[model samples]
Target chain A: MQESVDLGPEQCTLLLGAGITGRVALSSPDGPHIVPVNYSVVGEAVIMRTSPYSVLGTYGRGSMLAFEVDWFDHERWRGWSVVVRGRANVVTDPLELDRIRTTWDPQPWAAGARNLYLRLHWSEISGRQIGVGWDPVETLPVRRAV
Target chain B: MQESVDLGPEQCTLLLGAGITGRVALSSPDGPHIVPVNYSVVGEAVIMRTSPYSVLGTYGRGSMLAFEVDWFDHERWRGWSVVVRGRANVVTDPLELDRIRTTWDPQPWAAGARNLYLRLHWSEISGRQIGVGWDPVETLPVRRAV
Candidate 1:
Protein backbone atom coordinates (compact mmCIF):
# COMPACT_ATOMS: atom_id res chain seq x y z
CA MET A 1 0.00 0.00 0.00
CA GLN A 2 1.14 3.53 -0.70
CA GLU A 3 2.20 5.61 2.31
CA SER A 4 -0.59 8.09 3.08
CA VAL A 5 0.34 11.55 4.41
CA ASP A 6 -2.16 12.26 7.20
CA LEU A 7 -2.03 15.91 8.35
CA GLY A 8 -4.16 16.06 11.53
CA PRO A 9 -7.55 15.31 13.05
CA GLU A 10 -9.11 18.28 11.34
CA GLN A 11 -7.92 16.93 8.03
CA CYS A 12 -8.41 13.21 8.63
CA THR A 13 -12.04 13.06 9.79
CA LEU A 14 -13.11 15.19 6.85
CA LEU A 15 -12.06 12.52 4.38
CA LEU A 16 -13.61 9.79 6.47
CA GLY A 17 -16.97 11.54 6.37
CA ALA A 18 -18.36 11.81 2.87
CA GLY A 19 -18.52 15.54 2.34
CA ILE A 20 -18.30 18.01 -0.52
CA THR A 21 -14.69 19.11 -0.95
CA GLY A 22 -13.05 21.64 -3.22
CA ARG A 23 -10.37 20.58 -5.71
CA VAL A 24 -7.82 23.28 -6.63
CA ALA A 25 -5.59 23.04 -9.67
CA LEU A 26 -2.93 25.19 -11.32
CA SER A 27 -3.81 26.89 -14.59
CA SER A 28 -1.24 27.17 -17.36
CA PRO A 29 -0.86 30.96 -17.38
CA ASP A 30 -4.34 31.70 -18.76
CA GLY A 31 -6.41 31.52 -15.56
CA PRO A 32 -6.91 29.82 -12.18
CA HIS A 33 -9.18 26.78 -12.04
CA ILE A 34 -11.56 25.73 -9.25
CA VAL A 35 -14.08 22.90 -8.90
CA PRO A 36 -16.27 21.39 -6.20
CA VAL A 37 -16.31 17.61 -6.45
CA ASN A 38 -17.86 14.77 -4.43
CA TYR A 39 -15.22 12.73 -2.62
CA SER A 40 -15.04 9.58 -0.53
CA VAL A 41 -12.21 8.46 1.71
CA VAL A 42 -10.76 5.15 0.59
CA GLY A 43 -8.26 4.03 3.21
CA GLU A 44 -5.76 6.93 3.09
CA ALA A 45 -6.57 8.86 -0.08
CA VAL A 46 -9.37 10.99 -1.59
CA ILE A 47 -11.13 9.63 -4.64
CA MET A 48 -13.62 11.50 -6.87
CA ARG A 49 -14.96 11.76 -10.40
CA THR A 50 -14.72 14.68 -12.86
CA SER A 51 -16.35 15.41 -16.19
CA PRO A 52 -14.90 15.44 -19.72
CA TYR A 53 -14.98 19.17 -20.29
CA SER A 54 -14.39 19.36 -16.57
CA VAL A 55 -11.05 20.60 -15.30
CA LEU A 56 -10.29 17.18 -13.88
CA GLY A 57 -10.11 15.71 -17.38
CA THR A 58 -7.28 18.05 -18.30
CA TYR A 59 -5.52 18.49 -14.97
CA GLY A 60 -6.18 15.16 -13.28
CA ARG A 61 -2.99 13.59 -14.65
CA GLY A 62 0.13 14.04 -12.48
CA SER A 63 -0.66 17.64 -11.63
CA MET A 64 0.42 19.50 -8.53
CA LEU A 65 -2.63 20.62 -6.59
CA ALA A 66 -4.46 21.30 -3.33
CA PHE A 67 -7.79 19.94 -2.01
CA GLU A 68 -9.74 21.47 0.86
CA VAL A 69 -12.99 20.65 2.79
CA ASP A 70 -14.45 22.69 5.65
CA TRP A 71 -17.61 23.79 7.53
CA PHE A 72 -18.41 26.72 9.85
CA ASP A 73 -21.23 28.57 11.68
CA HIS A 74 -21.66 32.20 12.73
CA GLU A 75 -24.07 31.99 15.69
CA ARG A 76 -22.31 29.01 17.21
CA TRP A 77 -19.05 30.61 16.10
CA ARG A 78 -17.37 27.22 15.68
CA GLY A 79 -16.14 25.19 12.70
CA TRP A 80 -13.26 23.15 11.18
CA SER A 81 -11.25 22.86 7.97
CA VAL A 82 -8.75 20.50 6.29
CA VAL A 83 -6.36 20.85 3.37
CA VAL A 84 -4.48 18.13 1.47
CA ARG A 85 -1.58 19.07 -0.74
CA GLY A 86 -0.21 16.73 -3.39
CA ARG A 87 -0.30 15.47 -6.96
CA ALA A 88 -3.64 14.54 -8.63
CA ASN A 89 -3.81 11.97 -11.36
CA VAL A 90 -6.39 10.03 -13.31
CA VAL A 91 -7.42 6.51 -12.28
CA THR A 92 -7.18 4.78 -15.65
CA ASP A 93 -6.77 1.18 -14.62
CA PRO A 94 -10.06 -0.60 -15.24
CA LEU A 95 -9.69 -2.64 -12.05
CA GLU A 96 -9.25 0.52 -10.01
CA LEU A 97 -12.18 2.15 -11.81
CA ASP A 98 -14.39 -0.77 -10.91
CA ARG A 99 -13.30 -0.55 -7.31
CA ILE A 100 -13.98 3.20 -7.07
CA ARG A 101 -17.32 2.87 -8.84
CA THR A 102 -18.39 0.24 -6.33
CA THR A 103 -17.21 2.21 -3.31
CA TRP A 104 -17.74 5.88 -4.27
CA ASP A 105 -20.86 7.30 -5.84
CA PRO A 106 -19.74 10.57 -7.46
CA GLN A 107 -22.62 12.15 -9.35
CA PRO A 108 -22.59 15.29 -11.46
CA TRP A 109 -24.33 18.46 -10.36
CA ALA A 110 -25.61 19.38 -13.81
CA ALA A 111 -26.74 17.19 -16.64
CA GLY A 112 -24.61 16.24 -19.70
CA ALA A 113 -21.17 16.70 -18.10
CA ARG A 114 -18.74 13.91 -18.94
CA ASN A 115 -17.38 11.78 -16.13
CA LEU A 116 -13.79 10.84 -15.24
CA TYR A 117 -12.47 9.39 -12.01
CA LEU A 118 -9.38 10.90 -10.38
CA ARG A 119 -7.37 10.47 -7.19
CA LEU A 120 -5.25 12.84 -5.18
CA HIS A 121 -2.09 11.36 -3.69
CA TRP A 122 -1.51 13.58 -0.69
CA SER A 123 2.09 14.65 -0.05
CA GLU A 124 1.68 17.13 2.81
CA ILE A 125 -1.45 17.10 4.96
CA SER A 126 -2.21 19.65 7.71
CA GLY A 127 -5.32 20.85 9.51
CA ARG A 128 -6.78 23.04 12.30
CA GLN A 129 -9.67 22.78 14.76
CA ILE A 130 -11.72 25.46 16.45
CA GLY A 131 -14.23 25.48 19.40
CA VAL A 132 -13.71 22.11 20.99
CA GLY A 133 -11.76 22.21 24.26
CA TRP A 134 -8.31 23.68 23.62
CA ASP A 135 -5.14 23.13 21.59
CA PRO A 136 -5.75 24.16 17.97
CA VAL A 137 -3.70 23.92 14.77
CA GLU A 138 -2.03 20.59 15.42
CA THR A 139 -0.18 19.07 12.45
CA LEU A 140 -0.36 15.29 12.45
CA PRO A 141 2.44 12.97 11.38
CA VAL A 142 2.31 11.42 7.91
CA ARG A 143 -0.66 9.01 7.71
CA ARG A 144 -1.00 8.88 11.52
CA ALA A 145 -4.54 8.46 12.92
CA VAL A 146 -6.24 11.03 15.15
CA MET B 1 -8.88 50.45 3.17
CA GLN B 2 -7.54 47.17 4.46
CA GLU B 3 -4.99 45.40 2.29
CA SER B 4 -6.40 42.57 0.19
CA VAL B 5 -4.45 39.38 -0.26
CA ASP B 6 -3.13 38.70 -3.74
CA LEU B 7 -5.18 35.80 -5.11
CA GLY B 8 -5.04 34.15 -8.50
CA PRO B 9 -7.96 34.49 -10.93
CA GLU B 10 -9.32 31.13 -9.78
CA GLN B 11 -9.71 32.26 -6.17
CA CYS B 12 -11.20 35.66 -6.91
CA THR B 13 -13.68 34.42 -9.48
CA LEU B 14 -14.81 31.50 -7.38
CA LEU B 15 -15.44 33.65 -4.31
CA LEU B 16 -17.50 35.90 -6.51
CA GLY B 17 -19.68 33.19 -8.01
CA ALA B 18 -19.95 29.93 -6.08
CA GLY B 19 -23.19 29.33 -4.15
CA ILE B 20 -21.46 27.71 -1.15
CA THR B 21 -18.05 28.31 0.45
CA GLY B 22 -16.74 27.52 3.94
CA ARG B 23 -14.30 28.85 6.53
CA VAL B 24 -12.21 26.27 8.37
CA ALA B 25 -10.90 26.77 11.92
CA LEU B 26 -9.12 24.66 14.55
CA SER B 27 -10.21 24.81 18.19
CA SER B 28 -10.56 21.43 19.92
CA PRO B 29 -8.27 18.42 20.29
CA ASP B 30 -10.68 16.31 18.30
CA GLY B 31 -10.31 17.97 14.89
CA PRO B 32 -10.60 21.11 12.79
CA HIS B 33 -14.00 22.86 12.63
CA ILE B 34 -15.71 23.10 9.26
CA VAL B 35 -18.80 25.25 8.64
CA PRO B 36 -20.46 26.25 5.39
CA VAL B 37 -20.89 30.01 5.25
CA ASN B 38 -22.83 32.19 2.86
CA TYR B 39 -20.63 35.08 1.79
CA SER B 40 -20.21 37.82 -0.76
CA VAL B 41 -16.98 39.43 -1.99
CA VAL B 42 -16.42 42.93 -0.68
CA GLY B 43 -13.38 44.90 -1.78
CA GLU B 44 -11.01 41.90 -1.79
CA ALA B 45 -11.79 39.69 1.19
CA VAL B 46 -14.40 37.03 2.04
CA ILE B 47 -16.77 38.08 4.86
CA MET B 48 -19.26 36.13 7.07
CA ARG B 49 -21.10 36.56 10.39
CA THR B 50 -21.55 34.37 13.49
CA SER B 51 -23.06 34.70 16.97
CA PRO B 52 -21.17 34.81 20.30
CA TYR B 53 -21.64 31.08 20.80
CA SER B 54 -20.37 30.57 17.28
CA VAL B 55 -17.46 28.16 16.91
CA LEU B 56 -15.33 30.91 15.36
CA GLY B 57 -15.26 32.68 18.73
CA THR B 58 -13.35 29.77 20.21
CA TYR B 59 -10.61 29.88 17.59
CA GLY B 60 -8.88 32.51 19.73
CA ARG B 61 -7.13 35.70 18.70
CA GLY B 62 -4.68 35.51 15.83
CA SER B 63 -6.11 32.16 14.82
CA MET B 64 -4.97 30.74 11.50
CA LEU B 65 -7.73 29.74 9.06
CA ALA B 66 -8.91 29.40 5.47
CA PHE B 67 -12.01 30.29 3.36
CA GLU B 68 -12.79 28.24 0.28
CA VAL B 69 -15.32 28.43 -2.64
CA ASP B 70 -15.76 26.36 -5.78
CA TRP B 71 -18.08 25.12 -8.61
CA PHE B 72 -17.83 21.89 -10.57
CA ASP B 73 -19.66 19.36 -12.80
CA HIS B 74 -18.94 15.68 -13.45
CA GLU B 75 -20.59 15.14 -16.84
CA ARG B 76 -18.87 17.56 -19.13
CA TRP B 77 -16.08 17.62 -16.53
CA ARG B 78 -15.44 21.36 -16.17
CA GLY B 79 -15.30 23.51 -13.05
CA TRP B 80 -13.25 26.00 -10.95
CA SER B 81 -12.37 26.70 -7.28
CA VAL B 82 -10.62 29.22 -4.94
CA VAL B 83 -9.10 29.24 -1.42
CA VAL B 84 -8.24 32.13 0.92
CA ARG B 85 -5.68 31.71 3.70
CA GLY B 86 -5.67 34.23 6.54
CA ARG B 87 -6.07 34.94 10.28
CA ALA B 88 -9.46 34.45 11.99
CA ASN B 89 -10.45 37.05 14.55
CA VAL B 90 -13.54 38.65 16.06
CA VAL B 91 -14.85 42.04 14.91
CA THR B 92 -15.05 44.02 18.13
CA ASP B 93 -14.34 47.47 16.85
CA PRO B 94 -17.56 49.37 16.16
CA LEU B 95 -16.46 50.55 12.76
CA GLU B 96 -15.43 47.06 11.74
CA LEU B 97 -18.68 45.66 13.08
CA ASP B 98 -20.78 48.20 11.26
CA ARG B 99 -18.83 47.60 8.08
CA ILE B 100 -19.24 43.86 8.36
CA ARG B 101 -22.91 44.16 9.17
CA THR B 102 -23.53 46.59 6.35
CA THR B 103 -21.72 44.55 3.73
CA TRP B 104 -22.35 40.94 4.73
CA ASP B 105 -25.67 39.09 4.66
CA PRO B 106 -25.26 35.77 6.49
CA GLN B 107 -28.35 33.78 5.36
CA PRO B 108 -28.00 30.67 7.44
CA TRP B 109 -29.58 27.48 6.18
CA ALA B 110 -31.33 27.29 9.56
CA ALA B 111 -32.57 30.30 11.49
CA GLY B 112 -30.57 31.71 14.42
CA ALA B 113 -27.45 30.00 13.11
CA ARG B 114 -25.61 33.29 12.51
CA ASN B 115 -25.47 36.73 14.10
CA LEU B 116 -21.90 38.08 14.40
CA TYR B 117 -19.50 38.80 11.59
CA LEU B 118 -15.83 37.79 11.55
CA ARG B 119 -13.42 39.15 9.00
CA LEU B 120 -10.33 37.18 8.09
CA HIS B 121 -7.33 39.37 7.55
CA TRP B 122 -5.87 37.44 4.67
CA SER B 123 -2.14 36.81 4.42
CA GLU B 124 0.20 34.70 2.25
CA ILE B 125 -2.52 33.83 -0.25
CA SER B 126 -1.96 31.32 -3.08
CA GLY B 127 -4.14 29.12 -5.40
CA ARG B 128 -4.10 27.26 -8.75
CA GLN B 129 -6.24 26.49 -11.81
CA ILE B 130 -6.85 23.11 -13.42
CA GLY B 131 -8.49 21.51 -16.52
CA VAL B 132 -10.27 24.63 -17.77
CA GLY B 133 -7.98 24.59 -20.75
CA TRP B 134 -5.66 22.23 -22.57
CA ASP B 135 -3.06 22.30 -19.78
CA PRO B 136 -3.72 20.29 -16.63
CA VAL B 137 -2.24 22.31 -13.76
CA GLU B 138 -1.30 25.99 -13.61
CA THR B 139 0.17 27.71 -10.57
CA LEU B 140 0.27 31.49 -10.56
CA PRO B 141 0.86 34.38 -8.20
CA VAL B 142 -2.33 35.48 -6.39
CA ARG B 143 -3.44 39.09 -6.75
CA ARG B 144 -6.70 40.94 -6.27
CA ALA B 145 -8.13 42.22 -9.50
CA VAL B 146 -9.66 45.69 -9.74
Candidate 2:
Protein backbone atom coordinates (compact mmCIF):
# COMPACT_ATOMS: atom_id res chain seq x y z
CA MET A 1 0.00 0.00 0.00
CA GLN A 2 1.13 3.56 -0.62
CA GLU A 3 2.43 5.28 2.47
CA SER A 4 1.27 8.65 3.78
CA VAL A 5 3.61 11.64 3.95
CA ASP A 6 3.86 14.20 6.73
CA LEU A 7 3.72 17.83 5.62
CA GLY A 8 6.06 20.40 7.15
CA PRO A 9 5.00 23.76 8.62
CA GLU A 10 5.81 25.57 5.38
CA GLN A 11 3.82 23.12 3.31
CA CYS A 12 0.86 23.34 5.70
CA THR A 13 0.86 27.13 5.54
CA LEU A 14 1.04 27.03 1.79
CA LEU A 15 -1.95 24.71 1.59
CA LEU A 16 -3.89 26.90 4.02
CA GLY A 17 -3.31 29.91 1.79
CA ALA A 18 -4.48 28.07 -1.26
CA GLY A 19 -7.86 27.07 0.21
CA ILE A 20 -10.68 29.59 0.65
CA THR A 21 -13.19 27.44 2.50
CA GLY A 22 -12.67 25.09 5.47
CA ARG A 23 -14.24 23.67 8.61
CA VAL A 24 -13.79 25.28 12.00
CA ALA A 25 -14.17 23.18 15.14
CA LEU A 26 -14.83 24.75 18.48
CA SER A 27 -15.76 23.55 21.97
CA SER A 28 -18.99 25.08 23.20
CA PRO A 29 -21.48 24.62 26.06
CA ASP A 30 -23.52 22.35 23.88
CA GLY A 31 -20.47 20.25 22.94
CA PRO A 32 -18.00 20.36 20.10
CA HIS A 33 -19.31 22.04 16.94
CA ILE A 34 -17.97 21.96 13.42
CA VAL A 35 -19.00 24.49 10.81
CA PRO A 36 -17.86 25.40 7.32
CA VAL A 37 -16.35 28.86 7.01
CA ASN A 38 -14.86 31.05 4.33
CA TYR A 39 -11.49 32.26 5.53
CA SER A 40 -8.39 34.12 4.43
CA VAL A 41 -4.85 33.68 5.73
CA VAL A 42 -3.64 37.05 6.93
CA GLY A 43 -0.25 37.30 8.58
CA GLU A 44 -0.04 34.21 10.82
CA ALA A 45 -3.73 33.94 11.64
CA VAL A 46 -6.80 32.70 9.79
CA ILE A 47 -9.54 35.32 9.62
CA MET A 48 -13.22 34.91 8.84
CA ARG A 49 -16.43 36.91 9.22
CA THR A 50 -19.44 35.65 11.17
CA SER A 51 -22.51 37.05 12.87
CA PRO A 52 -22.12 37.81 16.55
CA TYR A 53 -25.23 35.79 17.32
CA SER A 54 -24.04 32.78 15.41
CA VAL A 55 -22.83 29.74 17.32
CA LEU A 56 -19.22 30.25 16.23
CA GLY A 57 -19.18 33.98 16.81
CA THR A 58 -20.74 33.60 20.25
CA TYR A 59 -18.60 30.76 21.66
CA GLY A 60 -15.50 30.92 19.52
CA ARG A 61 -13.79 33.88 21.15
CA GLY A 62 -11.23 32.95 23.85
CA SER A 63 -11.78 29.29 23.08
CA MET A 64 -9.48 26.67 21.70
CA LEU A 65 -10.49 25.79 18.16
CA ALA A 66 -9.34 23.88 15.16
CA PHE A 67 -9.40 24.78 11.47
CA GLU A 68 -9.07 22.17 8.75
CA VAL A 69 -8.96 22.01 4.95
CA ASP A 70 -8.59 19.05 2.63
CA TRP A 71 -8.83 17.85 -0.95
CA PHE A 72 -9.80 14.26 -1.66
CA ASP A 73 -10.35 12.12 -4.71
CA HIS A 74 -12.67 9.22 -4.01
CA GLU A 75 -11.99 7.48 -7.30
CA ARG A 76 -8.21 7.50 -6.77
CA TRP A 77 -8.44 7.23 -2.96
CA ARG A 78 -5.90 10.03 -2.57
CA GLY A 79 -6.08 13.20 -0.52
CA TRP A 80 -4.30 15.76 1.69
CA SER A 81 -5.55 17.15 5.00
CA VAL A 82 -4.27 20.11 7.03
CA VAL A 83 -5.21 20.95 10.63
CA VAL A 84 -4.48 24.11 12.60
CA ARG A 85 -5.06 24.35 16.38
CA GLY A 86 -5.20 27.66 18.16
CA ARG A 87 -7.14 30.15 20.24
CA ALA A 88 -9.83 32.23 18.52
CA ASN A 89 -10.13 35.93 19.23
CA VAL A 90 -12.41 38.66 17.95
CA VAL A 91 -10.82 41.46 15.95
CA THR A 92 -11.90 44.40 18.10
CA ASP A 93 -9.36 47.03 17.22
CA PRO A 94 -10.82 49.48 14.73
CA LEU A 95 -7.53 50.03 12.94
CA GLU A 96 -6.80 46.33 12.75
CA LEU A 97 -10.34 45.66 11.50
CA ASP A 98 -9.94 48.30 8.83
CA ARG A 99 -6.60 46.85 7.84
CA ILE A 100 -8.14 43.39 7.50
CA ARG A 101 -11.05 44.78 5.52
CA THR A 102 -8.73 46.57 3.14
CA THR A 103 -6.32 43.67 2.81
CA TRP A 104 -8.60 40.62 2.72
CA ASP A 105 -12.19 41.90 2.61
CA PRO A 106 -13.61 38.56 3.58
CA GLN A 107 -17.11 38.31 2.12
CA PRO A 108 -19.47 35.83 3.72
CA TRP A 109 -21.18 33.71 1.13
CA ALA A 110 -24.31 33.31 3.23
CA ALA A 111 -26.33 36.49 3.00
CA GLY A 112 -26.39 38.10 6.43
CA ALA A 113 -24.80 40.79 8.58
CA ARG A 114 -21.59 38.91 9.17
CA ASN A 115 -19.76 42.00 10.28
CA LEU A 116 -17.75 40.47 13.09
CA TYR A 117 -14.36 39.14 12.07
CA LEU A 118 -12.64 36.49 14.18
CA ARG A 119 -8.99 35.49 13.96
CA LEU A 120 -7.64 32.17 15.06
CA HIS A 121 -4.12 32.59 16.41
CA TRP A 122 -2.81 29.25 15.31
CA SER A 123 -0.27 27.69 17.67
CA GLU A 124 0.29 24.42 15.85
CA ILE A 125 -0.02 23.53 12.19
CA SER A 126 0.29 19.99 10.80
CA GLY A 127 -0.79 18.11 7.70
CA ARG A 128 -0.62 14.75 5.94
CA GLN A 129 -1.04 13.52 2.39
CA ILE A 130 -2.20 10.13 1.17
CA GLY A 131 -0.06 9.54 -1.88
CA VAL A 132 -1.38 7.78 -4.93
CA GLY A 133 -0.44 4.20 -5.89
CA TRP A 134 -1.55 1.10 -4.01
CA ASP A 135 -4.88 0.60 -2.27
CA PRO A 136 -4.97 -0.38 1.40
CA VAL A 137 -7.84 -2.84 1.02
CA GLU A 138 -6.11 -4.67 -1.78
CA THR A 139 -3.14 -5.37 0.50
CA LEU A 140 -5.20 -6.60 3.46
CA PRO A 141 -5.09 -10.29 4.31
CA VAL A 142 -8.13 -12.36 3.43
CA ARG A 143 -10.50 -12.83 6.36
CA ARG A 144 -12.23 -16.05 7.33
CA ALA A 145 -15.96 -16.09 8.01
CA VAL A 146 -16.77 -15.88 11.68
CA MET B 1 -30.75 39.96 -0.16
CA GLN B 2 -32.15 36.45 -0.30
CA GLU B 3 -32.92 35.03 3.10
CA SER B 4 -31.20 31.86 4.26
CA VAL B 5 -33.37 28.81 4.82
CA ASP B 6 -33.23 26.37 7.72
CA LEU B 7 -33.06 22.74 6.74
CA GLY B 8 -35.17 20.20 8.57
CA PRO B 9 -33.83 17.07 10.22
CA GLU B 10 -34.97 14.89 7.32
CA GLN B 11 -33.26 17.13 4.81
CA CYS B 12 -30.07 17.12 6.86
CA THR B 13 -30.02 13.33 7.02
CA LEU B 14 -30.66 13.16 3.29
CA LEU B 15 -27.61 15.32 2.62
CA LEU B 16 -25.53 13.23 5.00
CA GLY B 17 -26.46 10.09 3.11
CA ALA B 18 -25.60 11.64 -0.23
CA GLY B 19 -22.13 12.71 0.91
CA ILE B 20 -19.40 10.18 1.65
CA THR B 21 -16.75 12.52 3.00
CA GLY B 22 -16.91 14.83 6.02
CA ARG B 23 -14.77 16.38 8.74
CA VAL B 24 -14.74 15.03 12.29
CA ALA B 25 -13.91 17.37 15.13
CA LEU B 26 -12.62 16.13 18.45
CA SER B 27 -11.05 17.82 21.44
CA SER B 28 -7.72 16.33 22.45
CA PRO B 29 -5.11 17.10 25.12
CA ASP B 30 -3.27 19.47 22.78
CA GLY B 31 -6.45 21.19 21.62
CA PRO B 32 -9.38 20.70 19.29
CA HIS B 33 -8.57 19.07 15.96
CA ILE B 34 -10.48 18.60 12.74
CA VAL B 35 -9.73 15.94 10.14
CA PRO B 36 -11.42 14.64 7.03
CA VAL B 37 -12.80 11.09 7.00
CA ASN B 38 -14.80 9.03 4.58
CA TYR B 39 -17.95 7.84 6.31
CA SER B 40 -21.09 5.83 5.79
CA VAL B 41 -24.47 6.32 7.39
CA VAL B 42 -25.71 3.14 8.99
CA GLY B 43 -28.91 3.06 11.05
CA GLU B 44 -28.79 6.45 12.80
CA ALA B 45 -25.04 6.89 13.26
CA VAL B 46 -22.10 7.90 11.09
CA ILE B 47 -19.35 5.26 10.99
CA MET B 48 -15.80 5.28 9.66
CA ARG B 49 -12.54 3.41 10.05
CA THR B 50 -9.30 4.72 11.47
CA SER B 51 -6.03 3.49 12.94
CA PRO B 52 -6.08 2.56 16.61
CA TYR B 53 -3.14 4.86 17.24
CA SER B 54 -4.56 7.75 15.26
CA VAL B 55 -5.63 10.90 17.10
CA LEU B 56 -9.30 10.27 16.23
CA GLY B 57 -9.13 6.61 17.12
CA THR B 58 -7.57 7.26 20.52
CA TYR B 59 -9.47 10.34 21.72
CA GLY B 60 -12.69 10.06 19.77
CA ARG B 61 -14.27 7.13 21.57
CA GLY B 62 -16.77 8.18 24.25
CA SER B 63 -15.88 11.83 23.59
CA MET B 64 -18.18 14.57 22.40
CA LEU B 65 -17.38 15.44 18.83
CA ALA B 66 -18.75 17.18 15.78
CA PHE B 67 -19.08 16.03 12.16
CA GLU B 68 -19.69 18.42 9.29
CA VAL B 69 -20.33 18.16 5.54
CA ASP B 70 -20.96 20.91 3.05
CA TRP B 71 -21.33 21.79 -0.65
CA PHE B 72 -20.56 25.29 -1.78
CA ASP B 73 -20.58 27.15 -5.10
CA HIS B 74 -18.17 30.04 -5.32
CA GLU B 75 -19.58 31.59 -8.46
CA ARG B 76 -23.15 31.55 -7.18
CA TRP B 77 -22.16 32.27 -3.58
CA ARG B 78 -24.53 29.61 -2.35
CA GLY B 79 -24.16 26.43 -0.31
CA TRP B 80 -25.61 24.14 2.32
CA SER B 81 -23.93 23.02 5.55
CA VAL B 82 -24.82 20.24 7.94
CA VAL B 83 -23.44 19.67 11.41
CA VAL B 84 -23.84 16.56 13.54
CA ARG B 85 -22.90 16.54 17.19
CA GLY B 86 -22.53 13.34 19.21
CA ARG B 87 -20.33 10.99 21.17
CA ALA B 88 -17.99 8.77 19.20
CA ASN B 89 -17.72 5.09 20.08
CA VAL B 90 -15.62 2.26 18.76
CA VAL B 91 -17.54 -0.64 17.32
CA THR B 92 -16.32 -3.65 19.28
CA ASP B 93 -19.10 -6.17 18.89
CA PRO B 94 -18.11 -8.83 16.41
CA LEU B 95 -21.68 -9.25 15.13
CA GLU B 96 -22.06 -5.51 14.60
CA LEU B 97 -18.67 -5.35 12.95
CA ASP B 98 -19.66 -8.13 10.57
CA ARG B 99 -22.90 -6.34 9.80
CA ILE B 100 -21.13 -3.05 9.07
CA ARG B 101 -18.61 -4.84 6.90
CA THR B 102 -21.34 -6.46 4.87
CA THR B 103 -23.58 -3.43 4.60
CA TRP B 104 -20.98 -0.76 3.88
CA ASP B 105 -17.26 -1.46 3.81
CA PRO B 106 -15.48 1.79 4.64
CA GLN B 107 -12.29 1.73 2.66
CA PRO B 108 -9.70 4.11 4.05
CA TRP B 109 -7.83 5.91 1.30
CA ALA B 110 -4.82 6.30 3.55
CA ALA B 111 -2.64 3.25 3.91
CA GLY B 112 -2.30 1.44 7.23
CA ALA B 113 -4.02 -1.09 9.51
CA ARG B 114 -7.08 1.06 10.05
CA ASN B 115 -9.18 -1.81 11.37
CA LEU B 116 -10.75 0.12 14.21
CA TYR B 117 -14.31 1.15 13.41
CA LEU B 118 -15.57 4.33 15.09
CA ARG B 119 -19.18 5.48 15.12
CA LEU B 120 -20.54 8.84 16.08
CA HIS B 121 -23.87 8.48 17.86
CA TRP B 122 -25.29 11.81 16.82
CA SER B 123 -27.70 13.51 19.23
CA GLU B 124 -28.32 16.66 17.23
CA ILE B 125 -28.43 17.19 13.48
CA SER B 126 -28.85 20.64 11.97
CA GLY B 127 -28.36 22.22 8.57
CA ARG B 128 -28.72 25.53 6.74
CA GLN B 129 -28.84 26.53 3.12
CA ILE B 130 -27.88 29.85 1.49
CA GLY B 131 -30.55 30.48 -1.12
CA VAL B 132 -29.69 32.16 -4.38
CA GLY B 133 -31.04 35.64 -5.14
CA TRP B 134 -29.65 38.96 -3.87
CA ASP B 135 -26.24 39.63 -2.30
CA PRO B 136 -25.93 40.97 1.25
CA VAL B 137 -23.10 43.34 0.38
CA GLU B 138 -25.15 45.05 -2.29
CA THR B 139 -27.87 45.81 0.22
CA LEU B 140 -25.54 47.16 2.88
CA PRO B 141 -25.59 50.88 3.62
CA VAL B 142 -22.76 52.92 2.13
CA ARG B 143 -19.78 53.22 4.47
CA ARG B 144 -18.69 56.66 5.63
CA ALA B 145 -15.00 57.54 5.43
CA VAL B 146 -13.31 57.28 8.78
Please name the candidate that would achieve the greatest DockQ relative to the true structure: 2
Cα DockQ of the candidate 1 complex: 0.06
Candidate 2 stretches greater than 4 Å from native: A132-146, B133-146
lDDT of 2 by residue, A1-146 (tens): 44688877887887787666789998776677898888888888999889999989998888888999877655566778788889999999999888887767667776779888899989999988787454322322222121
State every prediction's TM-score relative to the real structure. Answer: 0.48, 0.86
**Distance (Å) between predicted and true CA of B89, model 2?**
1.4
Instruction: Please provide, for model 1 over A47-140, each residue's C-alpha lDDT reduced to its tens digit, 9 standing for 90 to 100.
Output: 7776756655775557665566654433444445566656667778988778766766555443444467667777656654445643223322
Clash pairs for candidate 2: none
Give lDDT: candidate 1, residue B127.
Answer: 46
lDDT of 2 by residue, B67-117 (tens): 998876555667788888898899999998988877777677777799889
Each candidate's DockQ = 0.06, 0.33
Best by TM-score: 2
Model 2 error, position A38 (Å): 1.0
Q: Per-residue lDDT for B54-114 in model 1, tens only? A: 6565552356666665433333344444566666666678886666557655444434545
